[model samples]
Target chain A: MAVYTEISDEDLDGLLAQYDIGQALSCKGIAEGVENSNYLLHTETNFYILTLYEKRVSKEDLPFFLGLMQHLASSGFMSPKPIRAKNGEFLQEVANRPAAIIEFLDGRSVKRASPQHCGLVGSALAQLHTAGSDFKLSRKNTLSIESWRPLFDGCKSGNPVELTSQLLSEIEGELQYLEANWPSDLPSGVIHADLFPDNIFFLNDAVSGVIDYYFACNDFFAFDLAICLNAWCFETDGSFNITKARKLLNGYRSIRPFSKEELSFLPLLCRGASIRFFLTRLYDWLNQVDGALVKPKDPFEYLKKSQFHRLVETVSAYGLD
Target chain B: MAVYTEISDEDLDGLLAQYDIGQALSCKGIAEGVENSNYLLHTETNFYILTLYEKRVSKEDLPFFLGLMQHLASSGFMSPKPIRAKNGEFLQEVANRPAAIIEFLDGRSVKRASPQHCGLVGSALAQLHTAGSDFKLSRKNTLSIESWRPLFDGCKSGNPVELTSQLLSEIEGELQYLEANWPSDLPSGVIHADLFPDNIFFLNDAVSGVIDYYFACNDFFAFDLAICLNAWCFETDGSFNITKARKLLNGYRSIRPFSKEELSFLPLLCRGASIRFFLTRLYDWLNQVDGALVKPKDPFEYLKKSQFHRLVETVSAYGLD
Candidate 1:
């Protein structure tokens, strides 16, 4: 779903010569990452990932993301550590794009989520939040609730009335509600705002690593938990599985206990997370180009999810014990 | 450019259990190969290529392609060897597509071909023809001269007069000339008809491997050489580089000497090869679908190439000694 730029062999050789890694055996563009072009680089001795930040990623925000990964790795969190060159620089230019090499993590993303996988993911997320607390660099989440209205307006011109009429009114009502009743007392820290199932890898029923930190930013720690509730606790048939939610919440609580205030606003935070995703998906759906590699995910899925979150009135409804 | 089917984690574990290879550490869909979805699979022990043949490839031709790779590898050729499962089957189903795991080859495909690279490729190709001579199975080249006319007709509907009018007449003239002057007697054997630069891998000015035997078939061995002349001896501007051609021919002659008759028909064979690729590219150009991952290569490049080949009247024009 990625690989927008083709890296030349000469460019690759020059890039690798700056590092301790030996000659590259092969460098294949990996079909994962959506925001950056990723190559699974194999050298004579080891494997690494070569990432070229595409136009979608902000160049100014790279240091924060890279430094955050390095800090987390140094803190014994399982994440890909950025490999430095002989000059001690981690970021360089490859094919005129900002590129870097990171140590390849050893695991695969699980497709079908089991309760055990959910538990491991939750524990890892909490650990990430805890480990990143002291990192010097911080970034604001660009895709937060404040950005959703503008994104929706960008897509308003192209969509049909049938698709937008109900969606628009409901979104308006929800945005007003969120603005008036937003929580202000919860602990704020670095949060992996987009830690879906695909971003977490597992080996032997344990979390091996966390990945795709492009959305990592200074946000509510409990908001990250709320994002996971919407992402992990939902089934394909539009029903919420309370068992998965229970396990995930328990796993997270074991690391850093949630405060009573954090638990009380979980339902509202989940609703906000649903709207954030629904608006983005709707924008992408409305503005999809002719030859995109990845298909736009259906916005209706998140709309139905928002409707479900709106029905939940108490924190215990999410299966938190 | 491939990966039409998604393989789940449970299915992957089940597939690997059938082989002696250990647990898969990662299986990334590689943005290489157009006809098949290829994953650069890494296990706890070694690396392998997991290929899921896409619909563009004929299922009935799997054995010939896989068998050719196996036969050449056993004969000390550097192509990837098909890894057999414990049940002794090399071809199996994964994600409902015919899939096989092959040993990973080291070395990267070069973007710019040096004369030395061309020389090594020519030498390796001659060795491949020699190694495949005794293989039991045989496949006819489906994209041979007989199919060019039909392929042209498929594209004739959409192409503009500026691109097709003169091209049509010239192609018709070349086809007639080639048909009348085609050699009736020559050394016939298995040949890799599509040995483009991308299909040949190089390491330290030496050929490490040859791959993509999907187009291997029973054909004139010299035709393979002629295909390489058209493929490897051309610059980006459509001019044939005589120095590179000289090295390539010398390298091939060093291994398997060509007959005088074969050399005499080389110019005609090169023209035929050019038109064969040109028609196919034109067909793909006219029939390209929206949202395809890979862009269609320019058909005009091959058209220009065919025009260049049409003007060459003797073998020496291709830098034959």
Candidate 2:
């Protein structure tokens, strides 16, 4: 939950002047998206999300995010379209930060994902991958397999007292194993790298919208599924619900059939995905910004997920047979 | 900025079942209102504010707050009416907290108040006072003059490190003076005790809405003006703007003319208002909730305002004849 920048009325007026939408009726800071300030901007015509990109999101990569949204939305995907300004740019500046007005899709993100919700999420994510296949812009996943070791090192150096020595050594061993076994060349495309349940909105038992494209990047589509497995299939008690995993995978495969190589590499990719989140969460936990509106998510949840995936021998364990 | 309660989908569904406002389309937690969890709820029919009262707001006072909004809005004041449920009740339960859905008013709170904006705010506030005059419910101001000494004691007990000995003594002296000289009689009615700039919204150069009735209660109307004087007339650098104050007073009197006694007591009321905020702010600053999203406002801002009000000899200092 965050609104890092306060957009003054002058800034808002200047921004609205660049758009043909309408005059600003109300602009409220919304408690969503930690990487940027988000406002639920109501205008004379319609409601739109006004986002001011903070320091965490690179201004250079904004076009890729905004462009990706435009591309997917135009291609009939569930992504909300980024509204181009009168200057024909999706990106603009507000309160000294990169900003944009985005179409407001009407759907509430589910607090708890049922098997049905997971199925819809899986299909929506696959649709996103298919819709984004021909997008001209591309960005490499910054928190992918290669960045794990350095992130782990940074977390270790930060000296988080909560991380036990045994836990640290276990993470190091897992990182080493993942570094050696992580798969490459497995049906790469645009992946919603962080497709947690919170990022997928559900209405009337269907995925109504997908949002928060800050982490969207070019990566293995199977790795995106792996991320979903870790995010959606896990219960609060740290047990994997294979039924949900089956529903998610089956839902995805029904849309875009997975290759044999992709299925074989699924377990390893899941482990890598867990390691990626575990390391980043650990880093954020160890080096939490003072007065940050968002509480750093617990790193151990991903650690347990990594441990679970480490024991899986084949796609059969994920009920993907 | 706060969203303390996380309402689950089931809770939201249960809430909507009690209302006829159409099925829930979306509900996004908004970074507005420090004392409650506020969501910008979009239903199939229209946009509304869904607020879940936090512990800071007394449960018994829920009816008064909601009812006062109903009274004001129905009487054609700028206040947003609380949406009643199918049973004709203005309040309901969500996530084990008292909650209500309020009609969404369209306007943006000013970031910086111009003198013209001040004039609008003044007239709107007077209109609120006039409209709320006949409301059956009455709540005594809990944070008024009598509560200042106890709040000051709490702050002193907390031993805020930033407060110097001299500052403490000055506050104590001011408290003594206010207690001795606080007026017993002036025109009294339901007052929106917390009329900060953010609590008022404007559109097309007029006040479109006045909100956050949690602090509304029976009090001297001139004291409400005094609160606005401290809130809207002070510049960021702590200088009082007499031009803005004059406009505000004149604008308010144009709506409901002030009595001579009310005018004579304005300076002392301003000091008391300052003390009221100073003690509460100091108490909050010294005892901030751990991991609170909203930062405690600097207590010293009110101290400076209190000091400024202390030296004012008459209403002329406020740019009045």
Candidate 3:
């Protein structure tokens, strides 16, 4: 509701004039996101999403996030291509906030998806992982398993549940298990690290686009598959739907099959994704300090999710294949 | 690692002088926290936590966060008392970071807790809820039940598995069930909205203290019990540990007995806690962007755990008359 610092109509038009996508028709703020201020705009020619950087995002990382979108768009993946300003920069200052306009993609998020739809999502993700492989960039995953130990240190400040020792020991053991058995030399590429249900859009039964590249970074392709497995494959009852998982893996293999190396590490990657989100969510929950615009979601949920995923070992996923 | 700005030792000493505790000790940077940069500073006087507000926290809400700490401290709760600077301000500019210092608490987080420990936690929590009943403040539970829709909105962005729609609808039904059956006038107090294992501390097999009141706000005390039931009473595999629940309830009742109204609301409150954490975790998992020093944990574990808690519509803990 704080429209005080948002971009006005005139400024929006001026920025759109620089892009080759014709003139602007209409633009309005998206009321949903807790992190950034987004505007869904309908231009004369094409739809677009205009986003203003919020406090949680760093100005320096803006280029990577924006450029990756542009890169992915040009690479044949369906996404909002970052528009350049008249000055040829993808980023511009509007309303004193770092802003950019991206080609809006049209798709409905799968509602009552069938197994076929889940398979398609898996296939689409695999293709995306393969497509992003050659992109020239290096973004070290900040939430990698190595970082888990340092973050565990914060839990020591106070004993709300004395989980630090248990969590740390358990996590350390997981890390050791992971280090001993991590999938190395699996097709590395730019990964959509946050490829949850919201980031993928479906045009009818077909995947029109995968959106939200802010968490996109260079990593193993299978890890992205693992992320999809946890997000797109789990049931509402928290049960691992193997029927959905099988279809998904099949769909992924149709585009780009997981090598033995990648397949071997699927469960660990699942654990990593699980633990990473768990720890972060817990940290956010306990800290209880967030900017006005950014609502701090509870971290305990993620911790719980990770713990659940840890129960599934590699043997469970591949099943002595 | 990104020490974009530096804090002088002298500047810190001035900040430390405000606390009425003994003498100063050493302040060491805690490398972990994803949201804020925290340092453990021990003095000849007492222990304290010096946190430099990171990009995630708002400068405007510093007063709310800082004042809440001071207020709770003054009200004889276990919270860090923010020290006012020479300018009579608790907020200070440190290394281009809006920072404040708080008292470091003693005790260890219970890692390997037994049914007895959970019982102690339950009792301490209820007593704490009683203590916070008359605290002067009206901060809304920003992460309340109403916030679940937006989280679901975020989750819906992706092509989740075939049953996602089923799950969402199921969750919506659960929310409505809670709304209609919600027990009003059930002992309102300042509830610790986030009461996971990692947040509570213990010492010498006794309840040492409860810290982290950022989520503390006016809500049903039964909601607090539900949160604990979902957190402590669950097994490692996320199944409901019925015996542990009895122990937890017994322990809480020994300190502060639950009212008839409170008892009736536990089943519903448990469901609410389960869904709340479930959706929040899923949202965080999907929305995770990069360049964070700390990791964002997954919410699925809590969601899964909540799903289990949701299954038991009746339990002996309620002592159904």
DockQ of 3: 0.01
Docking class of 3: incorrect
lDDT of 3 at A121: 87
Query: Could you tell me the C-alpha RMSD of candidate 1 in Å?
Result: 1.9
User: By lDDT, highest first, what's the ranking?
Assistant: 2, 1, 3
User: What value does the lDDT take at residue A150 in candidate 2?
Assistant: 84
Which lDDT tens digits does candidate 2 get at residues A148-187? 8888878776464666789889988888888788776789
The reply for model 2, stretches above 4 Å from the true place, is A158-164, B158-163
What is candidate 3's lDDT per residue for A1-321, written digit by digit as tens? 111245554576567667676665434444324467776555656556778877767787777788888777898888678878778899987767888887766554553456787888888787777667666766877777677767766754664555556766876676677667666576787888887766776654688878877777777787777777777776766566777888888888888867777776777787777767766666666665443333455565555656776776663553234
Where in model 3 is the C-alpha error above 4 Å?
A: A1-5, A9-25, A111-113, A158-169, A179-184, A290-301, A313-321, B1-321
Better of 2 and 3 by TM-score: 2
Chain A TM-score of each candidate structure, as shown: 0.97, 0.98, 0.85
How close is chain A of candidate 1 to the true chain A, as a TM-score?
Answer: 0.97
Choose 1 or 2, whichever is better by TM-score: 2
CA lDDT of A7 in candidate 2?
84
* CAPRI grade, predicted model 1: medium
Q: After superposition, how far is residue A289 of candidate 1 from its true place, in Å?
A: 3.3
**Candidate 2, residue A50: lDDT:** 96
